[model samples]
Target: MAPPLDTRSPSGPAVSTLGRSVRQAGIEDIPAVARITQEGPLRTDLDPESAARSTRLLLTHIAFERGALWVEDGVDGRIARAVAVVPGGQHSPWETVGRVVAPDLARVPPGPDADQAFRTELAAVAPRWVLSEISQGSRARPGPPTLLEAALSWARAEPGWRHGPIAVVADTDAERKAAESLGFAERWTGGPPSPWWLGVDTDPVAPGQA
Candidate 1:
């Protein structure tokens, strides 16, 4: 299992000179973050309850994990955007419920019990590590450049970290163009017209970036 992350960097949470401040998210921020995700090209193929439950669980896992969930707070004190850079390892809470379909995600009860159930589920899986990617909230609110910069900064500071490819799912022409602009190439297509795009790195660490 990977050690817990140090969310408080020496440079702080990479706050921009502008009014917007990018910082690690807390449990309190999940609601706003989830709402922000709805404004994005997120998948909605599942039933509303399942979709909402999965999103909530994801945000909970990342936020409580401390370093993965990044949120850009607007001058109004509301969350303008959110991003998550999930580091792969056996201990990652994301592995518990991420990528799961409706019934699995929906079966988990809400609130604190959900966390316990997720942990129990995680314990059943064998330990393994894989490369994950930086994910952002609504493209409508703010593009990922700044938030991604902050996320990468945190990631690079982690022990044994390495530069690597980024993966994203684009559901619209605009999103596809944006991904292409950032050097991501289409890797595969999936649910709801979303195509996976991968930004390859020439000098990634051996085995994987994680």
Candidate 2:
């Protein structure tokens, strides 16, 4: 079994103004989180089963750390409408960006090997904050702004991370545009070992305002 969950509630005021239920993802939410990402704009480029397994491992890694995986409830309250992964730690986001984009990581079987791969890469990744992923479901309700609002709120409240750089990776032209509309600017283009575009925004909205 995974370690005990941090009972310290996720920092930041609730974002209910969006008329969506957004909260930190728990162990039980793992499956839905996996399914949403597989069906969303950011593809793992894997088959259904593989993608689910891989995403589970990744989510498990985040679930254990100070980082957070926030999910918005669908119209049917029980299902996840969208997910946003906000990374937090001392390591720089640039250090582990390559490993995060590796296609082979998605193929690792759901076992000790997969756990090790995820743990290793995740340990090296600590950013002031990274909107690591923003995936939507078919019936997605809340948009990126709501998700980002929660992230920015948490960052402002977290020690040693107030108002620092926020990074986001874009996997398509549409995603790139969305990031731009949200105030992110292109920071890097893809190269070997990294297949996605990187965008950075130094100024994001504060808590309760977005």
What clash count goes with each model?
0, 0
lDDT of 1 by residue, 66-122 (tens): 336667778898776555555444354434324411112233223454444434433
lDDT at residue 73 of model 1 (Cα atoms): 78
User: For each candidate, what TM-score against the reference?
Assistant: 0.53, 0.59
Error of 1 at 209 (Å): 16
Off by over 4 Å in 1: 1-14, 39-47, 62-67, 89-144, 163-192, 202-210
Best by lDDT: 2
lDDT (0-100) at residue 12 of candidate 1?
Answer: 41
Taking the tens digit of each residue's C-alpha lDDT, what string does model 2 give over 1-210?
Answer: 123566544432445634567666566766776665555344356567765686567656643254566666655675454334445353544323322322223332234543444344444333466665444412233245555445545555555554456666554455566567677777665543433556777565565555
For candidate 2, list the clashing residue pairs, or say none.
Answer: none
lDDT of 1 at 114: 43
Off by over 4 Å in 2: 1-14, 17-19, 40-51, 78-81, 86-126, 134-144, 162-164, 190-195, 204-210
